[model samples]
Target chain A: MFTGLSAFPLTPFVDDAVDAAAYAGLIERLAASGVDSITALGSTGSYAYLSLEERSRVARLAVAHAGATPVHVGVGALRTSHVLENVRSAEAAGASGVLLAPMTYQPLTPDDVFQLFATVADATELPVIVYDNPGTTHFTFTTELYGRIAQLPGIASVKVPALPEGDAAASDRMAQIRAALPDHVTVGISGDASAAAGLTAGCDAWYSVIAGTLPEVALRIARAAQSGDRDAALQASAELQPLWNLFSTMGGSLRVTAAIAELLGLVAPRSLPLPILGLTAAQRAEVARVSDELGLGG
Target chain B: MFTGLSAFPLTPFVDDAVDAAAYAGLIERLAASGVDSITALGSTGSYAYLSLEERSRVARLAVAHAGATPVHVGVGALRTSHVLENVRSAEAAGASGVLLAPMTYQPLTPDDVFQLFATVADATELPVIVYDNPGTTHFTFTTELYGRIAQLPGIASVKVPALPEGDAAASDRMAQIRAALPDHVTVGISGDASAAAGLTAGCDAWYSVIAGTLPEVALRIARAAQSGDRDAALQASAELQPLWNLFSTMGGSLRVTAAIAELLGLVAPRSLPLPILGLTAAQRAEVARVSDELGLGG
Candidate 1:
């Protein structure tokens, strides 16, 4: 039931370790800042890199510290068994809900798509959100299938990264999904750069990534959107666009994470196990510069 | 150290369950079939659809029945953690090695790639094979990276699926990798239709999918290559192409798998899991006809 603002927190890391205190501290600050909802272990939260145990721990921390706010845990896995297991664990850890992308597995049919979400939906008491970030997952779900999955029990919302399909088509797709679903099911916008447009078009919520490492700026934009202050929302997105692109340009969970950590004044001691790389020196400076410009720094 | 043939066996399913008896039976037959090695839970095994428990049981059966033949257990997962876990399980099951693909995940760097294989290599005592099936995993390891991964201890070989890309350029790529590594590290051909070319071009081994379901046809192809009979190898490829293309086209893993089961008179049951669809009626018939034409029933 998030309305004003929802923040997907960037996971914190320190030299091959997940920085729980730093992460907890950030979540506490975001909660106190009147952010309506918190998404943990998300793409920004480095869900893919975290071991299942680590993922559950992060979800628990968010639920524990982000008081009164809904804590949405990321729950997509390569295997349906793992996804279901993650959902069960997240619910056990007191997550208000689970947010997941249909990535991590490939070339699945819409029926398989229905089954993946349905497995999680059936496994948990908590409401589920389906994330459709097609770029990383290497495929897309038709709006038609999204409509079908919405009919599944306890599907509270859908989290689709903004498809760069231009305004009219994107707006049309949003309207189609909205019309297909009951009014209670909301649509949240990922890809912070498109938050204002998503809100203007038809999306009910902004799952803000820029808000992740920088809650104040995120709150400003969310409050602006709440007040229908398009200009302010546009300005915030303008400041964020460069930083977002800096991490977003690269296509992996770990890289987005390294960029987020650098934004929050964390650095390379936060190494991912392997097959996931650290940011280059030049790229790190680029992240630093963009974060500074956005005031997303300590 | 295999020079002739390796087989990726089908894990039998009965009543939607991993039929342990049928699996062990199949492995017993395969072990006695004079194959250079045997691969457990590759595509023909419907490896992606299996739960960890099922996968573990299959691996155990393969190792127990393998005799002197090496067993390559498939270990591809969306998350690195699970891949590592699968690798550990494969090692625990006494598998000689694992065949890992960069599937369910994407956009990994050379270093990340190195780390993925290296971590699996380091975690266990077994030699691991790097599976590069771009048609499925979608991530191709460059020769430099392959050479680097080869240097990592326990990496016994590389498994390359032959596509049109398996050309002179591919041969050169193979040669470059071979030049950088020790003679013990073999380059294994995964595409049976391309095995003769790959072997002639200097790959050390060939892992056949068709050979798993149809030992007679597979043995012929392997024997033809062992004796340097290109004409006989090409004849085998002609019959095998329909089956390869049968599964490779349409519906991705599920359709390909359904085709595999249909031909072998095994319990493929239904289509693959979510996100993957079944073959059309005509395609199903094609799978049957190809199987019949190849006289695989014998």
Candidate 2:
């Protein structure tokens, strides 16, 4: 059910509460930009850090302001029952589908992972997008495990994380995963830095982080790739490479994007979980330099 | 405020619900065994896997059943606000202290780490135990960070995870930490296998997992170390080497201890997150063989 460029927006907070106005404005902007879908509560959205009530609110806000764009909600949790609960909340909030990551504090066996996804999928009628994000979840899904999960009831698509840089084997692996899965299941790629190459390698969609704040730019690259314009796609990706470089150097895009959102006056200044501070002055200056060079302004 | 051997009991679940009766019974046993302190909602207690309500319930149960033994509750969360909320719940539930871990979905910088502990310390009067369990929390506390966190108000002790086997440098490092901290601040060691060495090396407490189910054995070792009987302590630790070996090989003690708990009729069978399965028949037989040799049974 997930295809094209699906924007995962940052969850803005003010006075330790969800800044509903800021969030709604961001959602409206994404919808106006004609993004294919909007995913609420993604890694960039700080889904893990939000409480259940806040998650429900964010899902509702996104769906309400997303116009006709489908809203996919991240329902990953440490426990299966909690994930089921999140699925219900997302469904009630009118999300198009639920993104399920095999998140756990304990190491899960393949059987345990299968059971977690199967239980959640069986609990909800909404299409389930299996999210394989090893970086956050600390759980890597092997192709064998992915194949098994894809066959479960209500499983729609598998969101594969981008392979590390310069890994030539990743392209072949992506194709292999595409070939191994059933024809009905779509394969999407995460990691904004990887979308162009991933799409060129035949992945079906880009579940994007940068797209949440920079929809127009994200769409430009995604469209070029979708239309078989390799040169245009690469050029667009190269233009955003400075921002992507910041994401790589900073460890992840959440903080950089939050800083970008604040710079553009899209959200209020916020603090994420410790260790993930907002950009430093130097970093912010670099972001301004790059954004200006790319003609991006608030 | 924590001293001697502090038992960290497993949180048994029945049909995905916290088995209050089982949890209470476990706490009562730990207290009756003459353990110095009891820690609720610890890593062994599966604190991360539980919901807020379940955590509160577990904390209350632990406090209710602990009798004269002080209960230290784990108040770690992905967000600082949530940690504050958990501290309030723990205080309301009458826990003697709160154990804080710098847990986050993203890596935290030293400044971020300091802010997390300092903020929590400022919010509560309860003594806070800074937990440095790099194995699970995926965050490490350098001595520099520890020195900063040690100065926070209400920060009473620091829980140091046992270094990996054969790391001769750990002894020197442990001594350095103990010497650098204020005399009032206690240094505790976790990882049952390293308890004897940690205690012999001058740590004031052993935050133990094996002590949860096998308090008699853990105390025997800990007491020997406390009395400065190096030979006796080593002998006691040697006796539990079989069980310690299992913990190291299994990657953690939660499942192995749970399996042992069921074997000893302490709790019902339970499952942890995926990839961490319960012991196989052969592994169980090994546990039984070790327990029988050590005379550990209900």
Q: Give the TM-score of candidate 1.
A: 0.86
| DockQ of the candidate models in sequence | 0.41, 0.53
Q: Backbone collision count in every prediction?
A: 9, 7
In model 1, what lDDT does residue A290 have?
68
TM-score of each: 0.86, 0.95
Cα displacement (angstroms), candidate 1, residue A210, comes to: 3.0
- RMSD, each candidate, Å? 3.6, 2.1
For residues A1-298, write the lDDT of model 1, one tens digit per residue.
7455678786776655678887888788888878888888777676866666787788888889988888889987655656777887898889888887776344666666787787778878888888877756766778778888898899998887774556798788787878877777888887776777676666778887766656777777777777787777768666767765765676543465456665565444444444565676777677667667766665
CAPRI grade of model 2: medium
lDDT of 2 at A82: 74
All models: lDDT?
0.72, 0.84
For residue A15, what is the lDDT in candidate 2? Answer: 72
Candidate 2 on A1-298: residue-level lDDT in tens? 4778899998888877788999999999999999999999988888888888888888999999998999999998777777777888999999999998877566666777888888888888999999998877778788988899999988889999885454476678876897778888899989888888888777888999989998998999999999999789978998888878889886578888888888888998763444356777888888778778777673
Best by lDDT: 2
Model 1 lDDT tens row, B64-95: 98888878899876556678777878988887
